[model samples]
Target: MKTAVALTIAGSDSGGGAGIQADLKTFAFNYVHGASVVTCLTAQNTKEVTEVMAVSPNMVKAQFEAVINDIKVDALKTGMLFNQEIISTVADCIKSWGGDNIVIDPVMVSRTGAQLIDDSAVEVMKRELFPQALVLTPNIYEAQLLSCMSIHCLEDMKQAAAKIYDLGAKTVLIKGGAAEGKNKGIDVFFDGQGYTIVGIKAIDTVNNHGTGCSLGAGITAHLALGKSLPRAIASAKEYVTTALEYSLEIGSGCGPIGHFFPLIESQYNG
Candidate 1:
């Protein structure tokens, strides 16, 4: 039998926590073959990002062509596009390839709420890449930036989702993981017509280093497996929650969620 393929266009995380690393792991767990095109490289660990070096736009374009020409991608996700040039290159390539089933994880800010890319890059992504997305997944802060709205509650999340949906994406999911109160970790999904609140009990852990990447990749993997948007999101939600439950406290600061929690559990049990 042939396996579904998922592609991740993103940066390299030396810590093996986020970016392409997380995406591939999520793909593997979902029984999909994972491919990647690295836009940049980050010198960081579970603690913090120390330095970043981006690949040339030409190089990024080459990688994309190499993969798409030979392999068949059922679903594709973008994460941590470092600059405007890379964003434009990726957007152009995706357009030329006629690739759909896109999951865009607008990774402008870190989990700890630190800005990762410049405003110019963010602007380029909003203009060039966002409209092409089948699903746009943004955290509360990212949603706020994209929607230009304040999100303090579920109602605000819904409003933000609608606002982001207006930006050309067919669907939008505003993640409320950082929201306050009892209803934290809720995600508002807007499918151009209605809303679905995806929620689970928020886990309190410092090992949430790659939550966004993992969730986005998980959704992409499910989509590659021919799941509907709503079903894909639901499966991705459960996958991420379980990974969080088995998160690793390997470093001093924020660590990474266990991308292969079930595999690890089975190995230990055996």
Candidate 2:
């Protein structure tokens, strides 16, 4: 059987929780070959991101060229594009090489609702990158920034999803993980036709450091493996839920979900 291949253009998490680490793990589980172009290097653990150093635009372009020329990338995901220059470079490369299955995880806001990048980067991403997205996955805070609306309820999330879809992505998934209510983690999906809400009963855990990255990577992996967009989203949601259910308590602060829980469990049980 032939294997699928996926690429991640994202930052590197030194702690191996989110970013390229999580993306590779997710791709591995889906039986897809994983490739990466590191956009930034961050000194972060489960606790917090203390420092970030972005790669040069030329280096970013070099990596993109190396991957595209050698590997047949079935799908790709972007995370933590730190600045306008990097965003523009990536967008140009995608346009040049062609981007069919691009999953854009707008990593603009942190878990605590803090802006990670500036407005200029966000503006550049929207203008240059969003149009290339086959799928756009943004958490609550990111959705708010993109739609310029406060999401207090599920209906609000639906509205945000529509607005974001209008921004150029063929499909928009507004993650409601941060939304407050009885159903605290409902994800709204809009594919230019209508809306669908995907939710698993929220798992209470502080060890969710890489949930967004993992979710987006999983979807990308499935897409590479020939799954439909909606099926990929549903499967990715389930994968994240399971990872959260067996989340790893690694560091002093918020840790990472167990990307390989099922694999480990199988190994141990057998």
Q: Model 2, range 60-149, lDDT digits (tens) per residue?
A: 999999999988899999998899999999999989878589999999997689999999899999999999999999999999999999
Q: What does the lDDT come to for candidate 1?
A: 0.91
Per-residue lDDT of model 1, residues 166-214, tens digit only: 8888899887777778767889999988999998779888788899899
Per-candidate TM equals: 0.97, 0.98
* Reference-based lDDT, residue 207, model 2: 87
Pairs that collide, model 1: none
The 0-to-1 C-alpha lDDT of every candidate, in the order given, reads 0.91, 0.92
Alpha carbon lDDT at 9, candidate 2: 97
Q: Measure candidate 2: CA RMSD.
A: 1.0
- RMSD values for the candidates in order, in angstroms, are 1.0, 1.0
- Which candidate number would show the highest lDDT if scored against the true structure? 2
